[model samples]
Target chain A: MANLKNNRYLKLFTSTFKLSACTFGGGFVIIPLMRKKFVQELEWIEEQEMLDLTAIAQSSPGAIAVNASILVGYHVAGVLGALVTVVGTVLPPLIIISIISLFYKAFRDNPIVSMAMAGMLCGVAAVIFDVVIDMAKVVFKKKRLLPLLVLIGAFIAVRFYAVNILIIILVCGVIGAIDTVVHEKKGAEVK
Target chain B: MIYLELFWSFFQIGLFSIGGGYAAMPLIQNQVVDVHPWLTMTQFADIMTIAEMTPGPIAINGATFVGIQVAGFPGAVIATLGCIFPSCVIVMTLAYIYYRYRGLNMVQGILAGLRPAVIAMIASAGISLLIMALYGQRSLPSDLKQFDAIALFISITAFIILRKFKPHPLWVMAGSGLAGIILYTLI
Candidate 1:
């Protein structure tokens, strides 16, 4: 039993570390890779369970990759598993960024590097724009008035009013909670 | 004290940065750029470019990069810890609750509500970045002469390619870099 537990922990750590180190494009990319590793390969988690955990990971705070790892780790081996997974997931980025940072000054000052960054900045903006459009489309597909209002209202608050981002997030969360409660009550009354 | 500050800043970013890595952009920008003045807008854009190319969450990458720029390797370690600390606590508790209760309506509702707001936040970040890329400034320039037409052309072409073809983002970034070299350097 002890050996099995140790083996599971080791596997969890290594799997996450490998995924984090190799995968690019962040959470959306990593989550599918994780599902492949844990579900199809290891059979540690069921497909449905992985899906549920993914939804939870997406909804919760922090990086979805880290959150998903924490949930999976805990599911497999409890608290210690969660700790191990989180460390594994974080290590790759930390190591890679630290190495890049060492040479950042050189890159920043090089005229060639600066021009490339300038062009890459445009690419970055395009990618961010794509994200905005994609996410907004999902919200719009629901056809809800409150969501549309919140979307426009939040954008205006941040862009023009300069309201704090933290405040905006908190207020949105509260509004969402209240909206859910009120709808649930209506459903209950009808039923 | 600086280490403490780095830790706290990234901790808050982790705690509030809901949705995902892209959604975290505005929050990261607010802290490292607006609040602390640790990085300029262009430098922040460079970090975002690097984050997209790298193999990890942008939030983690951003924290590590900013920490290194502001301090050193120790700073990078501390900032990365601060960023993931919230994930460790929040995800574990939420996972426990999820298993205990099974279906969670409140979580679903809250996510639904947040969806639009998250989109808005992402849009806000994109707009600022667009302004920076086109005008070479944090905000729009009063005079049109400050605008970089070549940058605008690159961005529009990139946006069209992304929307139409949907190639991997790496290709778009690499193409842009090559374009930059040819247009800005070689020309």
Candidate 2:
């Protein structure tokens, strides 16, 4: 039993490490890969369970990759498994970024490099704008007043008012919680 | 002390990153760029580009890059840990609660509310980055002469390509880099 448990932990670590190392474009890209590894391949988690875990991961704070890894790891083995997976998931980027950082001065000073980076900066802005548009579309699809208000309000607060983002996030979370409780109460009343 | 600050800053980043990597951008900008002056807007844009190109989560990549730039290798380790620490605790607790009580209506509700806020945050970050990329400054320039028409053209073209063709991001990055070399360097 001990050997089998150790083997499981090791497998969990290796799987996450490999997945994290290979994944690019971040965010939702990792989800399908993870579902493939843990569900289709390992069969450690059921299909519906993985979906639920994904929902939890998406809704909660932090990187979805790390959050999903933690939940899957905990579901498989417990706290130790969670720890193992988190470390595995983090190590790849930590290693990659560290190496890139070493070249910081070289990259910063080279005019050619700077020009390329400047161009890439434009691309980055486009990508971010795409994200905003995509997400806004999702929110607007729901056709709710509060969500729409929150969207516009949050934008104005950060862009114009220069409100601290920390405060904005906290207030949004609180608003979300209250909105939820009220809806639940109303739901119960109607039922 | 720098290490402590790095760790704490990233800790807050991870905690409030609520939606995902993009949503975390405004929070990160507030901390590293505005609050601490650890990174300039230009450097922040560069890091975002690198983070997008690299493997793994953008938050983790950004934290590691900033940490190393700020301090060193040890800083990188510390910052990365700080960034993921919240995910560890939060995910575990939520996982346990989820299993214990399967109904997640509240979580659903919160997510619905958060969706719009996260979008707004991304838009805010996008605008800042756009200003930096097009005008070559952190904010809007005092004069129109500072604007780079080439950069704006590249950005608009990139946006249109992304919306229509939906090519891999790597391709887009490469295309933009090539355009930069041709327009700014070779010319």
Candidate 3:
């Protein structure tokens, strides 16, 4: 039993490490890739479970990748598994960023480098725009009115008022709970 | 001392940075640029580019870059830890409860509401990034002349490439950088 637990922990660490090192972009991109690894390749998790975990990961207050890693890891090997997975997942970025920081002065001073960065910033914006559109597609596909309203309202609050994000999330969560309760009550009445 | 500061700020960022990595960009900007002045806007933009290009999530990359830039490897590790700390704790708890109450409507409702707001946050970040790329520090009319046609062209071309071709983002980043060098510096 102990050996099996150890193997699971090791597997969780290595899988997440490999995924983190190989994948770029962000959590959104990594999600599908992880589904392939955890569900298809390893058969560690079912597709439905992965989807549910992903939804929970997104709703949580952190990077979806980290949250997903922890969920999968914990599911596999408990608290220790969560710790190992988080470390493995974050290690690559820490190492890579540390290397880049070593050349911080040169990267900032080089005219060519500055130009490249300037150009890449624009690229980053474009990529982000794409992400927005993609995610918006998912949200709008349901044709639900509340989510659309919250989307616009959240944008205005953040862009114009600079409202604290925590407050916004909490408020939206309350509204969602109320909306759910009301709807369920109506459904029961109809029955 | 600096390490402590890095950890705390990033911890707050992690706590409040709901939705996903892109949504955290603005919060990072506020902390690194507006609050601490550790990185200027241009530097922040460069880091964002690097964060996008590198592995792992943008939030992790951001924390690592800012941490290293401010301190060193230890700072990078601390910052990354700080960033993931919330997720580790929160996710473990959720994992325990979630399997038990997977069918709970309250949980479903909360997530449903959170999703759209997160999308909005990402949209807000994208707009800010667009402004930063296009106008630089010059938002006013007189400073608007600083706007570079070359940058605008690069943005549009990159978007088109991404939308049409759907190549990996690494390719898009490399292509844009090459274009920048050829257009801005060589010419």
TM-score of chain B of 3: 0.57
lDDT of 1 by residue, B1-187 (tens): 9999999999999999877786799999999999998999998998887786566899999999998888988888898989988888888998898777655788667656665765676577678767877887677778977788889999999999989997665577678877877788755
For residues A1-191, what per-residue lDDT tens digits would candidate 3 score against the true structure?
A: 98987888888888898877755545754565576578878898875576567657877899987898888888777788888988888888788777876776565567886777678767767777776776688777888888899999999997889887778878887888898999999999999
User: Candidate 1 has what TM-score?
Assistant: 0.64
| Highest TM-score scorer | 3
Lowest lDDT block of 10, candidate 2 chain A:
A23-32
What digit string (tens of lDDT, one per residue) describes model 3 on residues B81-168? 8888888888788899977776798877776777777767667766776676787741333665677798899999999998898766
Better of 2 and 3 by lDDT: 2
Could you report the Cα RMSD, in angstroms, for every candidate shown?
6.9, 7.1, 5.9
User: Any runs in candidate 1 off by more than 4 Å, and if so which?
Assistant: A1-93, A100-104, A188-191, B1-83, B94-102
Name the TM-score of chain A in model 3: 0.64
Q: Which consecutive 10 residues in model 2 chain B have the weakest lDDT in total?
A: B107-116
Query: Candidate 3: which docking quality band?
Result: acceptable
Candidate 2, Cα interface RMSD: 5.7
Error of 1 at B75 (Å): 7.9
Consecutive 10-residue window with the lowest summed lDDT within model 3 chain B: B137-146
Q: List ranges where model 2 is wrong by over 4 Å.
A: A1-89, A96-104, A177-191, B1-87, B94-102
